[model samples]
Target: MNSQVFQTPIEYLKGVGTARAEVLKKDLGIFKYEDLLRHFPFKYIDRTRFYKIRDINPELPHVQVVARLTHKEILGEKHTKRLIVHAQDDTGVMELAWFQGIKWAEKNLVIGKAYIIFGKPGMFNGKAQMAHPEIEPYSPEALKGKGNVSLQPGYNSTEKLKTFSLDSKGLQKLVAILLDQFAREISEILPQYLLQKLNLMSRVDAYRNIHFPENATLLYEAQRRLKFEELFLIQLRLLKSKLLRTQKFKGNIFGSVGQCFNTFYHDKIPFPLTNAQKRVLKEIRLDTQRGVQMNRLLQGDVGSGKTVVALMSMLLAIDNGFQTCIMAPTEILANQHFISIKQLLGDDFVEVALLTGSVKKKDRKIIHENLENGKLKILIGTHALIEDAVQFQNLGFVVIDEQHRFGVEQRAKLWRKNTIPPHVLVMTATPIPRTLAMTLYGDLDVSVIDELPAGRKPIETLHFYESQRLQMFGLIKREITLGRQVYVVYPLIQESEKLDLKNLMDGYETMSREFPLPQYRLSVVHGKIPAADKAFEMQRFVKGDTQIMVATTVIEVGVNVPNASVMIIENAERFGLSQLHQLRGRVGRGAEQSYCILMSGGKLSREGRIRLDTMVRTNNGFEISEIDLQLRGPGNIEGTQQSGVLDLKLADLATDQEILLQARKIVEDIFARDPQLALPEHQVLHYAFASKNAGLSWDKIS
Candidate 1:
């Protein structure tokens, strides 16, 4: 039978009896031959050299000793079994202690026998001691190619697994058994030309070497091949999805939004549309009027005037007598959008309504009645917008603000609200790098508002060590005296009180005491506070009722107090660059000049220094995001909360951005020449795609 068909315990393999198999399954997750083959080592131990006993230091954590077992002694009562052995190397004498299985340990260590012991050396009663160390009997086979061993496989196991008898060596033996027996010469998935061009190893070679490499160079090569396979498959999936979309989904083509723009520009609007706003609106207009359904991502830095563009797009749907829904992630943001849209389109007497989870039952009933009857042209709400009870009259378009926070399934569900899937426009203040935008959103067209509105003053940023606390406080006070509000933000960690690490509670009390004045109203807000109380405090700050507000990173996203001009971030080093930039954005939204004071701790690491320096140098979110991607990598951005993303195992989304582009090019070229991958030469590529797309067999699903 083919080895692959042995989908049972490793112990069932030819030489592995039930006893060893029990140990294999317990110590390792290897239930099958394939599982054993893929169980790669965590790290390796080098036991090449042996030191003289006299040269040994008790304080040293680990040491290699070549010695002769001088004698063995049993100590302690029956309840506490213990065995002590004495050994001598060229340099000095060392003691070996064993807690349990004393008799077995004593039998292993024979008197006047030379052997090698690898273990941690420690002080015991002012003498050197090695406790239950790894002892291997002296033999040419055991020390073969002395000091040449690379990485040793460390199989994952639990205490129960260990007791059941499975260990790393047992797992390794089973893996070797599988490799020698069932391992097949699978067809290469990648084309020969592409493999040579990319200098990649074949699938079988990569799978083998990734689990059990001959050396470091082979290991690196294997890893590179695996990473490439993962990324290539991801690109293929996206392209396939895009193909399906274009082939199956038909778009709703509306008349040019150009006419409504002219009307708003000439007669209906109060203020002149910002040049940046006009540019983005034109892009949206072009996208909507195209034959294809518009799936566009609208990205802008904070305060870059994206809201106006979103409003204008909705106007296009409204003018065409179709309905539009703007979905925000939270009620506060939804309410904010409702207020802004109401002001922007009021001249046309367009009926706009806000629907949130907390809307009164009576009010919701009225809103639902108006919504189904086509009386409401635009409905702005949070997740409540997608409720089954609320049906749109036409639902021609969907606008998702701060779209990254929502999942793909959630977005898809919202799109399904319309009979013919609505044209989608996703808006975000977080500026993602363009390369990431292409790979992650290849199905969607992307338009960026790169420029801020004219006449907006640049926010000035400064960095300070803890020593400059007094001076930082003075700057905040000065800003407050100038009729601008000050925001003091604290850091959140696991838990700490003595160090006082500038938590929100500490900052709130300090502000209340240090800056206590009848005129200075200090409002406090933090994550621990109830949503209602937090919103109340935030509103107070927005309305200028509170001159200084102390908050946590909870203010990173939605608190819009344009009147606040000074942002003081305590323990700024603890915060990420993109986040600090977002906090800085809260200020400088209005006419007043804004200042951001970054109060870091005593010393900063190289990364911390770079983050602070970057903040001080520029307020560009895109640049900061680029730096963040470089420093922290993708998993930081693709948390579990951000679902349906391509959670690539091997691809470094930032550094390998160029690779993504190359993969896309290759996919397009290959498909254009051989769309079905039916060419004999392309069959390998087809199999490779299938193997990877079938859900990576090697990857553990967490």
Candidate 2:
């Protein structure tokens, strides 16, 4: 057997014809002989020993017993037909039955014949039973063929495949045939020197042992080799892409620290930058001076001063005679940024504009003219900033806040706004754990602001039952009396009879009745409302015209209201830990001590209790994110799943963080030695990399 034989269609294999090949391809995505070989077993069972029928119990995983069939019968009608056979050992007897493949079993099975039966043992109606067990003739060759030292491999199959005798045992037989006929043609992927350096098993031997290993030790070694290969290749591809992009895309050099940046820093400074903020600024400054496009992921917890860092970076771009833009996920967030930036840079130095979907056409026209003419120094807005009509004059730096909300294509549109892509600084308040960041944003340099600024008190979080609504209301009243507004956030917008949850509309009604008219001015906002109405309500809340703002999760991202001292989250358990953290951030922005009261039903699930306990125990967003990752694996986390980054078959980024680090280090070292992967020793790697990324272009939203 050679390369051509390895490329042979699987239907040409013995015992497989056109129909079986079609079922195999449709059910399991196996087309050619190589596909069958690559279909690895998920688990294995030892078949060196057999258990007696009397020794078999429901607690045992899987057992093989030598038994004689005493009786055979087909019972029930048509679809309900069951082939039942009572199998007896010397000490005990058990019933073996099959509902599917009944006709095949009935035609093949004979009465009073000794067979080696293998299956899981379970108690059915107070009697031991083995349903749809693997049966073979009782002979020495049959016992030997079962394997003496090798573990039996289990294959996954579908119901359609099982109808044609292609269950695990059938598929295993097919794999065993391929192994016996063509183990020599499995091909080598890793170089001999590299394999020796890593002490990994040979590629062909690894493939053989992975399917049917001689022992547990061999299986472990085989899995290690395969997982390392997979993870190493992925990390290598990402690191190489990063290296190429850095060399290819040139960035605008902000060579001067002009008066606008210096004056704002020294004269009109609102507060001193924390050590963490200064450290991050140094990193950004170094990136801007490097003359290569800087694609960086700036991660921070809520209230960690990510906005100030973004502002200073934007000012740097302006000082260098280049325009900058800040793209926020929502219109509310965009307006907040616009107002905050305007307040911070109120001097007659830089002109700032706001662009969002709600901006009037006349204002947009003027903003467009100023932008094209390079008069606007800073433009802060939502997705509308990336429209075709929106153009920029030397857009040097882009700061995308809450970057995960925008798709990669939307971000790419912003990149195309300039000839050489603008220096990208993406910010997210959701603290991505180190393992997640490695996989999700591996192509970007990461900088984290782990410290909150001084003089900002940690928000006090407390848990309460729904029965104590009056107590919570009293606390909210006390906060309001202190000249502060409050946010009453409900998880649902409308009440539903099916769910045991509070609705925003009903809560607003109850609040109005409790403190009617002028006594308590309230503003209502929700996702279902018009954008203008929501903004109006939000503005009223911001301006202190409304004492209370009732809303849903629409305010989860970037709602900055310092006067809102109290945040009452209804049915807090209904939201995720990350979402709850963002909502808690809405308050505690002012100098006064803020409180986040979590009100929920008395009955809480285990996970819900853990979430609330974590919230109450710590104010650290990174700790909360780690716990959330453990509770719900990376797939359920908000942004990473949209891209195919976490579509892993072997290595898990959640638990295999150490392996990921090792794989990344290995890639770095390999590239350090051979930058182009052109050496003869690295030909295997070049082949693997090329094959893995065959038709996939490396273009991305840097």
Q: On a 0 to 1 TM-score scale, where does candidate 2 land against the true structure?
A: 0.89
List of clashing residue pairs for candidate 2: none
* lDDT tens readout by residue for model 2, 575-674: 8998888899999887899999999999999999999999999999888998888888888888877867676655666677777887788788888998
For model 1, where is the 10-residue window of minimal lDDT? Answer: 693-702
Candidate 2 error regions (>4 Å): 1-50, 59-62, 73-83, 138-187, 467-471, 495-500, 510-518, 691-702
Q: lDDT by residue for model 1 over 1-702, one digit each (tens)?
A: 232354555667876778756666665556665555556666555445556766677666567776789888888788876888998876678899999767778776778888778788887777789888777666556556432233445566566655644566555655666666555633355688989999999877886676567667787898788767667777676676676686677777778555655576677665666767777788877766775677888989998878878877887877777788899988778878887777766655677889998899999999999988888878899888878888877788889988877877778887787777888899888778766676667667778888877768999999988888889878878888888999888886234856547767767877888788796899888777788898899889888888998888788776677788999999898888878888898899888789999998877889989999999999889998889888987657533235344566456778777777787788888877876667878765544443433232322211
Which pairs of residues clash in candidate 1, taking residues 3 or more apart in a chain or in different chains? 3-182, 23-166, 41-153, 44-152, 52-91, 53-91, 53-92, 54-91, 54-92, 189-684
- Computed on alpha carbons, the lDDT of every model, listed in order, comes to 0.75, 0.85
- Best-fitting candidate, scored by lDDT: 2
- What are the models' TM-scores? 0.82, 0.89
